[model samples]
Target chain A: MKRRRRFHIQPKHLFLILLAICVLLIASTSYNTFMTHSIQGGFSTVLLPFQKGMNRLGGLVYGKIGSIKELYGVMEENQKLQEEIGELRRENTRYQLQLKELATYKELLKITDEYPDYDMVGAHIISKNSGNWFSTFKIDKGSRDGFSVGMNILADGGLAGIITSVEAHTSTVTSIIDDGRSVAAMAASSGAPCMVTGNRLLLQEGKLDVTHIDKDDDIDLSYKIVTSNTSSEYLPGLLIGYISDIDKDTNNLTKTGKLVPAVNFSRLDTVMVITTLKRTEG
Target chain B: MRKPVFYACVIAAAFLLQNNLFAAIPLIQTTPNILLVVTFVTAFIAGPKDGMLVGFFSGLLLDAFFGGSVGFYAMIYMAIGYVNGFCGNYFYRDFVTAPVLLSVLSDLAFGILVYFFGFLLRGRLAFMDYFISIIIPEVVYTALITCVVYKPLLKLEERALESSKRSAKRFV
Candidate 1:
C-alpha cells in the first residue's frame, strides 16, 4: 500500500514535475535563439568536404570536353554549310521586297512633294503591356541616339502617337487612341479643323471617334483626318485616320463621328520616332 | 514511419518530374490527377479525421505549387477528408463500382465548392461556366486516376492501420 502511494504522486509533486518541464523548454528556446549562427556554422563544416570534391570534379570534366570539341572540325563544317543555305534563302526574299517597295516610294514622293513642312519618323511597335494594354507600350529607340519625348512616332501610313517616355535603350509611346491624349485634327476634304478627342473607348471596340466637328461639316466615310498646325501641338497634314461613321445630330450644335484608325494596332513590328520638337522663340 | 517518409519522397519526386522532365508518357495530364487520387486512397483507408488531416495537407501542397491563397484549399480538402470518413461507415463490400463513382463525386464536390467560393469572393456567380468547364472535367480526370491508384494504396493503408491497432491493444 505504501509503495503504491509513493508511485502515485500527490498533487504538489505533480506541480513540481510540470514546473521542471517549463524550465527545460524556456532554456532550450533561449539558447537556440541566441546561438543560431554558431549552430549553422557547425552544419557548414560537415558539408565542406563534399562541396570541394564536386568543384574539382566539375573542372576536370570541363577540361576534357574542350579537347574533344576541338577534335570535331568536320561536324562543325557541316553545321556552318546548313546555316549558310538557310540565310541565303532569307536574303533573296528580302531583296525582292526592297525593289517592290522602292517603286511605290517613288510614286508617293511625287504626290506628297507639297507637304515639305512635315518631318516624319518611322518606328516599329516592339512589345505591348497588353495585360495593361491601354496605358503604354515599349519601342526599341532612345535619347542617347536621336530619339526624345514629344517626338511624333509614325507608321508607314498614319500617325501612331507621340513619344511620352524615353530611356537610353527603349521608349514608351502612348497611342493617340488612349483616353488621356487628344489631337488637333482636320477633315482633309472639307479643309475644316476641329479638336478631336482620342478614341480610346472606340479603340477597345476596334474603332475610334473624331469628335467636335459639326453635323453640317463635310466629314464622310474613307476621307482622311490629319493632325493640323492650328491648335497648339502636332504638324499640319499628318494623317490620323479615315472617317468611318458620321453621326448626324439634327438638334445638337456640334457633331461626333467614328474614325477608322489607319494604323493597324495588331501586326505592328517596326516604327520610327521623329526626334523633333519645334522650339518657340519666346 | 519509413512508409510515410517514402511517400513524402514520392511527393517531392512527382513534383520535380512534373516540372522538369520531358514526357515519355503523354497520356497522364489529359487523363488524371495522380496526387489527388493518392490523397483519396489515404482518406478512405485512414477513416475520417486522419484522412482529413492527410487530405488537407496534400491539397495544400498542390495549392502551394500553384501559388494559390493558402486556406482556400485547406478548408476544401478537410471537408473532403471528413466526408470520406463518414462514407467509410457504409457498406465496404461493393468496392469495384462504388470507389470510382464515390471518387468522381468527391472530386466534383471539391471543385464545385472551390468555384462557388471564388464567385462569392468576386461578388458574381458564374454557375453555368464553372460547372461545365472546371468541375466536371476535373472529376472525370480524378476518377480515371483513382481507379488506378486506389487498390495499391488501400492495401498499404489496411496493413498499417491493422498494425497500429495491434500496438494500441498491446499498450492496453
Candidate 2:
C-alpha cells in the first residue's frame, strides 16, 4: 500500500514568512520607494477625519479637566496678572520711545528690511507618536496646504521644529528636542557660532545642549541664540533659545552650554509653518 | 469573518485612543502602551494564530501613522504576539496576576527591542540613560494600565467568541 502525502502549514513557517515580509518592508521604506510613499499617503488621507475628530474631543476633555483643577489657583493668578499688566504698561511707553529713536536711526542709515517677509500658515497638532522614543507629531496642514518637508515650524515666537514628512492632509514635524536633531545657531549679540543639539535627557531640565562655540568668543548668559545665516536648512535670525550656562570643553578649543528654549514644547497646540524653503545656491 | 472584523475594530479604536486621547492626557511623562495591552490580551485569550494576526495589523497601523520606518514596529509586535500566545494554555478568566505580570515583561521586551534598533544601532551608546528614562517608565505605566484594560477586553473577546460559535451552528 502506498502512503498518502499531505502538505501542512505549520506555525513556524508562518512566522518565518511574516518575518521575511517585515524585512522586505523595512528595506523598501529605507530606500523610500514611491510605492511606500503612496501607501502611507493613502492611509493618512483615510485616517485624517478620524484623527481630527479625536483630537478635538481630547482637547475639550483636557480643557475641562484643566479648568476644574485650576479653579483654586485662578484668583491668585488673576491678581498676579493684574500687577504684571501695570508694570508692562509702564515698560510699553519706554519701548515706544526707543522704537521711535530706532526708526530715526534706520532712516538715517537707509537700511531697508534686513530679512524678507516669510509666508506662514497656521496649523493645529492632531496627534503625536505613541512611544516616547521620538518627539514627532502630525499637524493638520499637509502637502495640499502647501506644506513640504524642511519647512520651519515656529511656536511661541521661537523655532520649534522642521517638517519631516508631508502627506495629503497631514504632515509630521520633528521638534528640536528630539534626539539626533541639531541646528546651526549663533549668539545674537556677538555672532559667535555654536550648535544646538537635541538630547532628551537634557530636555527633561527644559534645556538643550549648545556646543562648539569658539573658546575666545565673548558669549554670556545675556546673549540669545538664533539660527545662523550659514545654516543651509534653517532660516537666518530665527530665535532658538537663550544661553543659560557655558563651559569650556576639555579640548580647550570650544565651549559648551545649556540653552533654555523660548518655546514651551510640552504645551504646544498651534504652530506657524514658514512655507518658505531656504533656497540652496547652485 | 465576524471575529476578525470585531478584533480589527478593537485594535483600531485602541490605536486612535493611544495616539490622540491618552497622548493628550498629561497623566505621566509617557502614556501607557494600550495597543500592546490589547495585542497581548488577545493573544493570551485566543491562540497563537489570532494573536499574530492582531499584532501584525496593529503594528502596521502604527508604522503607517508615524513610524520612521515600516515593518520595524510590525515585526516587534508580531513577535510579541507570537510569544504571548504560549500563555493561552495557562490563562484563566479570573486570574489577574498572570496578565499584569505578562504585560510588564512584554513591555520591557518591547522597550529593549525598540532601544536596540532605534537607538543602540544608531551608535547611541547610552544604555543606562535610555533604559532608566524611557524603558522603565513606559514598562511601569503599561503594567498599570493593563490591569484596567484587561477585563473589558476579555469580556469583549468572550462575547465575540460566543456569538461566532452560535452563528456557525446556525449555518451548519
Q: Which residue pairs clash in candidate 1?
A: A122-A271, A122-A272, A123-A270, A123-A271, A123-A272, A124-A270, A124-A271
Q: Give a tens-digit lDDT track for model 1, residues B1-172.
A: 2445544644443333322121112122232444555555665666665555565555444333221133445456656666676666674723746678778878777666755665435443556655665466667866875776667667766776677666555655
What would the TM-scores of all predictions be?
A: 0.40, 0.87
Candidate with best lDDT? 2
lDDT score for candidate 1 against the true structure:
0.57
RMSD per model, one decimal: 17.5, 5.3
Most accurate candidate by TM-score: 2
Error of 1 at B18 (Å): 23
Deviating ranges (above 4 Å) for candidate 2? A1-8, A72-116, B169-172
DockQ of 2: 0.50
Candidate 1, chain B, TM-score (2 decimals): 0.77
State the lDDT of candidate 1 residue by residue for A173-238, as single tens digits: 777776436898898878776566653335545567677787677777787888876745565677
